[model samples]
Target chain A: MARPDQIRFRRSTLGEDVYEALKGLVLEHSLSPGDRINIDALAREFAVSPTPIREALARLEADGLVRKRPLVGYTVSPLLTRAEFDAMFEMRSLLECTSARWAAERADAAHREAVSAEAATTVAPQEDDPDGWHAAFTALDARFHDLVAEASGNGLLRDGIDRLHAHLHLHRRYFPYAQASATVEEHRRIAAAIQAADPDGAEAAMREHLARARERHLAAFD
Target chain B: MARPDQIRFRRSTLGEDVYEALKGLVLEHSLSPGDRINIDALAREFAVSPTPIREALARLEADGLVRKRPLVGYTVSPLLTRAEFDAMFEMRSLLECTSARWAAERADAAHREAVSAEAATTVAPQEDDPDGWHAAFTALDARFHDLVAEASGNGLLRDGIDRLHAHLHLHRRYFPYAQASATVEEHRRIAAAIQAADPDGAEAAMREHLARARERHLAAFD
Candidate 1:
């Protein structure tokens, strides 16, 4: 059996790898917002043909990380404006609250266990191990939300929630651990409600968590 | 200024035409559900190179009209099953209700006119002119929903609603004019609520319309 790290040996196509690399560049602002992407230049830098780069750019455009013009090539999409951020949250609230309500009623034992485990997990103080803690925190947080969405048993709703969260992640400013405790506690409350099969409670808790999350991120717009 | 028909005379790049043509083929079931799409064959058929076909397939894949695999080629997605139809209606309810509420509060004069114009217009009769009347009904129905979404002024929500409706269209069975009156009257109720700037009324009316629409379409599953 492959070890945890050895899972990387699983063959992914070149296109998938290229897509990830290009997405990283955009998310980390290496390819800064509104920067035009030159297909030939990227091809030279990646030491491959422009085909994969073009494919990746098209996928990224679908993901809302970039935009393409008719005759002109692709450009990194500008950061989410303050107004867009509110719209994003409103969309999230509509989907996730419904997901939580459904998940409470529908989640089977396996999904219930998964959601609980993810919610109970937490990051150590980032002062000692900033990068490791930050990655763990983000992944756990994302997984908890995704698990709830999955447990809702609605593919359309789950896909919408997942994509909106990814879009929200792109707008996040880099930061460490300050609100980690509050966020984790909120997840626990939501998870508890779902596990208890309290549909209204789960929905309300999710709504509260999203409201708080919006408050936490609102400063990034400034 | 160009006439409505003359708008098509404006030049579009090869890729745009290819994309639209391919989308039409899928929606009309000319390319039936689960049919594999061959780039080379499609290029030959369309009298274009394989490059444009590949680009169009990728765009169609993004639109949920087709699926692509790593080594294998693209295939049209299967029709929505009964379960998926339920999920689709659920998602539409969540997004469109929010849109209608916001549109009620936010719609400007132009948007109000557009929504009213679409709702007020109707197909005379399909007994003599089935195809033209069917086309008119579909376009007007779609335009009304889109106008409300646009009037909401929430790009993310609007785009989600638009994409879902297109996805729904792809699954539709060809029929003519039976439910047109009921659907149009429901649309009128929703429009009246929005026109009156009553957010709660608009939301409730949209929700009621969606529930009835779902009931109307449920027999297709059987």
Candidate 2:
């Protein structure tokens, strides 16, 4: 077994690795939004041919992190505008709030335990530990939301939420942790609602959380 | 201007053509559920190399119409089970109901006219015109639903609902239209709700319609 810090590629799929690497660059803002991606240039930079890069780009395009034009090739997706951010949260309020409600109604003991465990373990990223905090926060945020979506017991709905969350993360990278403590508290309340099997409470809590989150992101522009 | 019946491929993108052709096969039941898709055979059938075929499969996989395995290759996605169908409808109820509500609140006069026109013009498929009916009904059904989603003004949510409806259509091909009149009537009621700007009414109408649709599909299994 590899150690926790050890990097392992069990399958060593080049295309997948390239996809991750490219996604990292995007998330880290090295490959900035709306930047045109030159396939041949990326191939040369990665010291491989164009095939893997193209495959990676295709997957990224499907993920909504990249866009492809008919004759113009691919470019990094543009950052979300204020209106888009509002639209995103409205959609999230509809989907994730419903997810929370369903989780309250449908989550089994195992699901409750899993969500509670995550809520207990996750900590707010500190100001000084920017890189480490970013990584920790991203993982925790994804897990917390993903578990709620999974507990909804609707695979298709869960998938849609997951995709939207992925695109949201791209915009999220621009903002710092202004309301981390509030976020943690909100997650606890959401989890508690679900654990208590209060469907309406869970839905309301989730909506409140997302509304606050939207405010936090909106404040970034101001 | 080209006629509606005319075939037009201005760009002649082979991958897109293959994707549409393959999707048509799946919709028409020429490519049945759970059937393994041989890439080489598809390449031969299309008289093209493996690249475009692989691309088409990748897109289809993203669309949830097809599945890909590591060593086993591609296959038509298996039929949705009873539980999945129920779950799918539950998710759709959440999404499309929200869409209907938003369409009521947000849709402009043009959107209202488009939906009203579809509801008014679309007739139940005749007994002797199964194929023509299928094609016409499919187009009108998709357009009606899509117009509502578009009116929601949330591209992400609209895309999610669109994808789910696509998968639902795959299952819908198997069941004969037992209540096409009910469907048309339901559509009219939904349209009327939106046109009247009654958000709650629209949402309720959509949910009721989906519930009835679910019952119809469930009856198919018996």
| DockQ top scorer | 1
DockQ of structure 1: 0.52
Question: What are the TM values for chain B, all candidates?
Answer: 0.90, 0.90
Model 1 C-alpha lDDT per residue in residues A14-133, reported as the tens digit of each score? 667788899878765688888899999999998888777777776777778888887788898887888888899988998899999999999998888889998988767767787667
lDDT of 1 at A87: 91
Candidate 1: list runs displaced more than 4 Å.
A1-12, A128-132, B1-12, B127-132
How do the residues B1-222 of candidate 1 rate in per-residue lDDT, one tens digit apiece?
Answer: 666854555366786799899988887678988899989999999999987777777677777989887778889998888778888998899999999999999989889778878889887885788766766777777888999999998999988998898777656565535777999999999999989999999999999999988887776666
TM-score, prediction 1: 0.91
lDDT of 2 at B8: 73
How does the DockQ of candidate 2 come out?
Answer: 0.43
> In model 2, which regions exceed 4 Å deviation?
A1-13, A45-48, A124-129, B1-12, B124-126
lDDT of 2 by residue, B119-207 (tens): 88766557897877877777777888998898777887788788888788567464447677788899999999999999999999999
Residue pairs whose backbone atoms clash in candidate 1? none
Give per-residue lDDT, candidate 2, residue A136. 79
